[model samples]
Target chain A: MNAEAAQPYRLVVVSGGTSDPSSTRMLADRIADRVASLAEARDEKVAVSVIDLRELANEIATALVSQLMGPKMTRAIELLGAADAIVASAPVYKAAPSGLFSSFFHVLDNDLLIAKPVVLAATAGTARHALVVDEQMRSLFAYLRTMTVPTSVFAATEDWNSRELGERIDRAAVELLLLVESGFAEKVRTESWKSYQHEYGSAGGTELDIDLSTDLMRLATGGSAAPRRKP
Target chain B: MQFGVFSVSDITRDPVSGTTPSEAERIDAIVKIAVKAEEVGLDVFAIGEHHNPPFFSSSPTTLLAHIAALTERLIVTTATTLITTNDPVRLAEEYAMLQHLSKGRMDLMLGRGNTAPVYPWFGQDIRQGLPLALENYNLLHRLWREDVVDWEGEFRTPLQGFTSTPRPLDDTPPFVWHGSIRTPEIAEQAAFYGNGFFANHIFWPSSHSKRLIDFYRRRFEHYGHGTQAQAVVGLGGQAYIAKRSQDAVKEFRPYFDEAPVYGNGPSMEEFTKGTPLTVGSPQEVIDKTLTFQETFGDYQRQLFLLDHAGMPLGMVLDQLELLGGEVVPVLRKELAARRDPGAAEAPTHASLVAAKYGDAPARQPRPNANRGDNVTGGSPYQDGDAQAEYPSLG
Candidate 1:
């Protein structure tokens, strides 16, 4: 079935920094490289797709208002959809994730991130906002129902030079690699897909059971019967 | 194969003229567009139901009923009657009355209306939009089929022995098409009930439409309606046609660029290339629309968004003339030529009545004059036709 070509893991990196060479994307790239190395060490062929939010700033804002994604933006969303693990790093602005970064995710299908393993990382100008990675990004991913690794990498301008930042990156990358190999995201979608609530009409992933006892189906058929099975 | 136009009735300023039509003028124009659809030899005219500003079609049945009266052969319908906010009992009564008035030239598409605020305005929760649609449609489906129905549901008040008035024409409920931009479960609901599944094929790319319609078609087969080819499917298309492709684009680009729905997102060329939207010559529209049949596999209905984005009434009529005259006739002949013989035709009042009765005399339910008995017993109809009636159903 062409199994070799289908990488065992797809690690997608979402960099939310507006600046081209910002520390946020650097933090994301460092973690992504570590995750790739760790997956290779474990003999897992992981393909990575990086989506830079800076490139999609206008498209994201337009999609927020227009509800339609242009081709480039749509492809980026598709990559996120196919990812087993995500390295999501956002620059903290006003003690929260960048609006553009959050807007990009807001435009995505709600069920797209469910059960996806994410390595949350954030870069701030000061150490006081370092906790924003967990406080903001983790909770945001939590709302998306994505599983975040315990070790969230937070890099401030000063902390970028510290040994703790590199260790945290390695720790988060190792956790994501473990998760991607576990295949929990695909497993849950394949197994318990109907348990989640999709954005009512977003055409998420699974066909739901229409109860036979529901007044319409009962009236349509004149009695309660078994739910229609998926073919 | 049925071809027609569905209007969102958006009251947008004409980008070229820098003028906007008044609500009254726009409503008048919407009716004119429907009449023009008929004159162009189209099969259907569906209007969307919207409850907000800049969009005028608040009561689609009312407008559709008027269109039904004005036109002879055109089958009038809702692009989607909101299944979420509207009361199921009211839906049953109003649509049935419209059915009688239109003399059976009516059917409808159901959707969980997209607007978020209308939900709260109607005393419903936006969070429970899907459930509201599920439960409300459940009740509405029963009220039309069963004359006296004791119904209980989560969304609204339970009814004990409630009879929706002016029972469906010939006791046949209007046919329904479940219109979904994305929901596979709604597609499942359509498949489970053997109704039509319509994809709004304009906004999204063809791949999106293909995925959703393909799932619906597969499930329609699973539920034993027929083979996948025989599933009743409808697709929404948007076109701005002229004799020459360049002229069409030249005229439509400004409107497309200023379009409230999808403007400012993708370029007109890119949007048209990615989605079912074709702003080109009649020949271009024909070739592009024909690919939809190839992609989605012989769908039953093809409705276009012809009147949105403030295209003037004369221009809309001209496009319809081009569509109905040049494109649809060719499409009808071509699609019909390649149509799967086993595929179901689009449902209509006549077809549904025929399906309900094969060469057998159709029922004409005549209620007895009520004796102060509070309710008529046994069968309310004097003719008492229970031969095809469902038995002991609850």
Candidate 2:
């Protein structure tokens, strides 16, 4: 929604940290602050919500094993669904982001995050895992078909004492804000929705791209339902 | 409305006993269960088709034919006869043969079975599942309706004047129900043909069913099949009942926790609340089932999964008894009480014959003595008075 018209932009932060005093959640909070300040600087209002996947670890495991999303997962999904921009941060595991983070997205409907601008960040113990955001998380978000901001912020133990971490965070947050302010996600949702598969049961716009003249649809509407795409 | 039981035919080990029923034992149990479906007051019995181990019913027609021969009243069907891998021509012939054998007491639900390896086993590509299903069903629709089908589609070889043998009984094909859980296009296809839409309602949430069923109903009305209320709908549910609800849960927990499809995913309570699986007394089952009608509107058929997760043969039979005697009779009356009078009855061969002929004599589809040229013959039969006109799209 256009902030000048009706509603402020929705920003969702997903933190995949497993422990207290988590550096992953700390990066997510900083990214959220940077994005909010950037949007405020541009005279645009934004509403931010944080989803701590650490709290939902058991639920995620159950959903993975069961193929059913319980109530907790559903709330997390809802927050993502309404997001104009996403700040996703996960602590590095092995050489990649946490499996808890990956599984949470797997449990989501495929079409949920298409073309949304996602700012990628990760907290690692050492600089050796610094490319976790670029090498792993970038392609992960790419699979969901989200537009990852060019500048991905990575926080390592040494980077916390350096100025580069704050600089990268500012760059990533500003890039996300630019995309959000330009309504890029909404544009993709509206303009290219037909290019994606329309899941029937999901709540969204249904009137835009349903081709009524297709044989099945023609049979469905009995030749009387109004023709879509008159031109 | 018709109410019945459908099984996946999984030969699972009893989680409590660690004893897996032998294939022979499971097979015998399934046949007995089907027979018991009719022995009680149930109206339908559907068996699933699986080519792999752990699931035994490979030839549904053979099994259904056996059940049909054994029972006089019950409607025998497939939970889903795979539409993607199986040839449509064979489908037409085999189902017609089943119809003849059953004496017009069979119908089948079609699905794009998600078992990936089965696709390659049958020489089909899993990636083309949707298109294969669509094109194959388009041809199958023709094979049953048209006397001579000249067909070409993306997945299969072109047919040159293929005449699928043993025409459907009464010159009216068995009614079909399309079973879908998530795909909207499948619901669209079911509505397109004015066929029944069966939601696999046990695994998924009611919101999912509500959306798909409501979509089908609206499209059914749009397609001039009927008002949204008059559209034919079938739902799959699961219930385990005892005299007391707690006993039902205690008895069913092990089976529920270890079953292949949904085991180890959600707690029984979470699953019960999220989806349609109910473990309770007869009264509780009845109460939960009534909510289905309230949610999806008055539907035409309700099929429950009674025998899965290696519940003992004795327990399965006992569950069927409760379902048929205690649960279904009440559901039949309660579902009927609020149903719109003008809504279509569950379609059967006899009902379809009545629909095709009204009071007139239904066509017998007599065969010619020896017709060599099925391609050029104006009518392929000798007593070719009433060759029904079919859509020539395929």
Candidate 3:
């Protein structure tokens, strides 16, 4: 058996929906379910964990203002850090993703989601926000350096009942499954994590490597900025 | 352990009184507060450096010098002198002058000031803050120790043959504590030089400070300063004390609600729980503080943020009374008992002088007669190396 068949992939679903029975969360759950079923069909397992952003609203706001991560926020970060793949869903508001969705990612360490496989999905009251997923949200995942699937899922009130949305979800789920099976995130993290810029405690406080060979580190050690000029 | 108060030097309006103290009034009030710190048997009084309004201490040394002359035992220092914006040459000269005026009762903490606008006002870029701070401090380090420095650095003009005059009091550079919230480079810089690492532990959780402190300690040991247990560390905390916990909470709530930085974000109870803020009785404050030692191992200094958030002078004085009378005494005794045998002591000028010059007299730099050229020819001071050479312009 291959490495993917021997161990379960940890898939984390982040829903930025505020209501109890949020359609945004429903879209994410649908995508997550599809991913798990697809993995199981290949004799692979997926452990799905949901991070309901509404539950962490206060923590997110507190973190943005004070840089103090509440327990719930810390737990969410822990979930994201270990996630092999992610299903990030947000509610579209004012031609953009919800402020809560954007703010949650804003407080995260830049290096936390690097090289992770992600499936971008969004829900809105009207079908006009269908482009919110690829147009607005994809750039955010790109900035985080996540490998987003070629197919993105978007569900408006009308599309929720349509067959096309289901097809899109399946296409995205297969893409995510293949990426996870490839172990791309793990390979990048283990092999090339140092190629990315990282602060001292970035990557959910796990990026603790200190490179003492840089010009800044040299200056930090009482050496001049230009190494060649030093006698 | 050493206990003291450090002010951000904010001239914030009193939320209860609904009145802001003018810069003149706040300036006078800080001097009184520093004097009161000594009167209440506190060890250190540090003021922050700010170049903007709503804060008065643009020149910390000027205020600290007067405070030092007023109080005998109190050590006047900075919450942080700006290492990013200020010229390192001026810092070396001005602080050396402060060290002289205070008669060896001063030390300063260095930090990169976070205000973005303040950087451009001083001909600096905020993007270059870390390198600027690191490079500036490297120059300042040599300026104080070496009588005539032949230095070149990235951020500032190269010094061909420059002397930061009024040489350090007793020829011993004042002890420096590098204060940082999250930057490990600052901690590494401190460790590489065997300087003290201070964590401004007021805003964040203990776990965050613990990570940096742990890194600093490990790196301090790696640099062979001493064992991890012997690394000099300082922590900043926030507290408000009354006889009753409820009363303390009630009194500090309004100020805590409207205070700068963290105000309006989290409730007082949440903040006190999440951070090192302790709004309770003196015993409760002492218990919370003792946990810092448990969390960070043996630390040297613990400075409290008691006077900020527009707390009236009388209220701040009352807080100090409780702190000096009930809290710090017990904390001192407890921390002393629990201190690791290998832990370093809180740095003081006298101790630094003693370390630099055992039983011998400390060197007092006297300048040679001027050559009427604006630059000292070979060595600036009479006792410096006479054979030292500098390239001539002619």
Could you report the DockQ of all the candidates, in the order they appear?
Answer: 0.23, 0.35, 0.75
Docking class of 2: acceptable
lDDT of 3 at A77: 96
Candidate whose TM-score is highest: 3
Rank order by lDDT, top first?
A: 3, 2, 1
Per-residue C-alpha lDDT of model 1 across residues B289-328, encoded as one tens digit per residue: 9999888888888999988888999999899889989999
Clashes of each: 0, 1, 0
Q: DockQ score of candidate 1?
A: 0.23
Which docking class does model 1 fall in? acceptable
List the lowest-lDDT window of 10 residues for candidate 3 chain B: B385-394
lDDT of 3 by residue, B1-394 (tens): 7889999999999999999998888889999999999998899999998998888999999999999999999999998999999999999989999998998889999998667899999999999999999999999998888877887777778787788787899999999999998888899999999999999998888988899899999999999989999899999999999999999999999999999999989878779989999999999999999999999999999999999999999999999999999999999999999988889888888888888899999888899998899987578888888333566687
Native-referenced DockQ of model 2: 0.35
C-alpha TM-score for every candidate: 0.85, 0.91, 0.97
B-chain TM-score, candidate 1: 0.95
- List the candidate numbers ranked by TM-score, top first: 3, 2, 1
Model 1, residue B386: distance off in Å is 7.0
lDDT of 3 at B306: 96
Candidate 3 error regions (>4 Å) = A228-231, B386-388, B392-394
User: For residues A1-231, what per-residue lDDT tens digits would candidate 3 score against the true structure?
Assistant: 475467788999999999989999999999999999998888889999999999989989988898678889989999999999999999999999999999999999999999999999999899888899989999999999999999989998999889999999999999999998888998998899999999888898898787778888888999866756434
lDDT by residue for model 1 over A163-225, one digit each (tens)? 988898899888887777677887988898777875433523233344444444443333322
Against the correct fold, how does model 1 do in TM-score?
0.85
